[model samples]
Target: MTKTHEGYFFEDYRVGQVVRHAVPRTVGAGERALYHALYPARHALYSSDSFAQACGLSAAPLDDLIAFHTVFGKTVPDISLNARANLGYAEGRWLAPVWPGDTLTASSEVIGLKQNSNAQTGVVWVRTTGRNQRDEAVLSYVRWVMVRKRNPEAAAPEPVVPELSDAVDPRDLVVPAGLDFGSYDFDLAGEPHRLGDYAVGETIDHVDGVTVEEAEHMMATRLWQNTAKVHFDATQREDGRRLIYGGHVISMARALSFNGLANAQMIVGLNGGAHASPCFAGDTIRAWSEVLDRAETGAPGVGAIRLRLVATKERGGGLRGADGKYLPHVLLDLDYWALMPI
Candidate 1:
């Protein structure tokens, strides 16, 4: 028997299958330090214990993306090891705050599959949930990836594309327990623009940029323990360049948004997102956001803001071209909801 693990292919997946991913991670202050070093993340709720306590959290919780990336990393070996691309995401929600010393485990349920016309690859959809040591779900999301077929001639499974929501309803957004923004410090939080200050249809260019570096991107991927082949194996692509991980772009864009949206803290819901274009090292990434809507949350003095965050290679580029296809300069299109002061 060969001791090597070759990983799963598109044909290996079936609807209704459940996969418990390996390598649970215990995240602590170290992950937070590294995350701040890797990205320009400076949200006060995540950056300061005193600030978070004032806002009613037990303490400064790990950055939401820290929880996200750690959990998503655990699924890569089983979900996207042989993937050609990670397509998109939808209906994601952060269920609970991930405190320091929390151990996270992940599992995925295969829900949808569709073979490609070329028969060389197929798309597989999975709903993944991340839980803490107490078995409380910390995060949940649906993602699809295009995986290569080990045997192109294999018989195709019946296509079962899931009917996913276009966006997460604001009422369903989870507010961390004890989360009160009544005492939120606008000065320490870095911006005074409260939820009421933002109008629907308004756009804000973050007005900053970061040049993606090969080493930093790889380090971030390794930190998350994401073992996707295309992100690490140069030979995986004919172009001979390691593709920057999509989550890396997401963190960078979210960090950059701080300049203008500093108080839009605690991401609670991810409505939808796309890796609109492949990003590589040396690309200068810029971010912009549009306020899509606002809603009152039941949390004390807290409100929810819906945002369309766009990341682009160029400083200010249009999202779609005339044909409604993503422009080449666009790198990511993320729709999400965050908690802010009323």
Candidate 2:
């Protein structure tokens, strides 16, 4: 009998199956410190306890993406350990604020599956929910990954692609309890741009760049407890370099957007995202954003702005080439909804 525990392959997944991932994590100030160290995140609401209190929160919540990365990392072993790629994301929403003393656990339900034309790999879709110590869902999203089939000759299962929402309806966006930007301080927040200041289709170049470092990327990945081979093992790919975790790019880019979007405080929804190209250490990542749409929220003085954030290696590289495939320099393309003061 084998004493090893190999992760699930594509064929192992069945629609409607639920999996509670192991290793619940208790997050505290330490994780918060490293997060600030890893990215240039400086959103005022997340930076100051007083600011958060004034905005009706008890204190500053953990960086939204920290909650996101920590929860997403928990699903790696069960979901993407055997993955060829982290394909994309959709219909994600932050259900609550994660406090410092909170413990987070992750679980996933297999909602859809499809064996690809090439028997060697198949796509697995899962709706994942992250819960805090109190058993309240903190975050939820759907992600699909391409996982390799142990045996190429395995019989294909009938595809069960779940019908997902094109975007999270604004009415469904959850504002943290007591959150009120009605008295928000524009000076403290660093940027005076509010929801009305941004026009739909308006593009803003974030005007900053950070060259990713090997030590830093690994430290961030380990801090999140992600053990994906492609992220840590250079031998996993034909190239002799470890692939930078896609979430790293997401956080780095989100942090960079702060210069122009400082008031875009809390991330409440993730409409779609893609790791269009593989990112490796030593790449200098730059970001840009386009305001896609805007809507009024029920929260007092709050509004929702849907944004398309793009991260690239080359300064002027576009997301898609004429052929409709992602340009080589395009690293990530993310569409999300954020809370801004009206």
Candidate lDDT (C-alpha), each = 0.95, 0.94
Prediction-by-prediction clash tally: 0, 0
| Per-residue lDDT over 160-262 for candidate 2, one digit per residue giving the tens place of the 0 to 100 score | 9889898899889999999999999999999888899999989999999999999999999999999899888888999889999999999999999998999
Q: Per-candidate RMSD vs. true structure?
A: 0.6, 0.8
Scored against the true structure, residue 142 in model 1 reaches a CA lDDT of: 98
Q: Point out where model 2 deviates above 4 Å.
A: none
Best by lDDT: 1
Candidate 1 achieves a global lDDT of 0.95
> TM-scores, in order shown?
0.99, 0.99
Residue 36 of model 2 has an lDDT of: 95
RMSD over all Cα atoms, model 1: 0.6
Model 1 worst lDDT run, 10 consecutive residues: 313-322
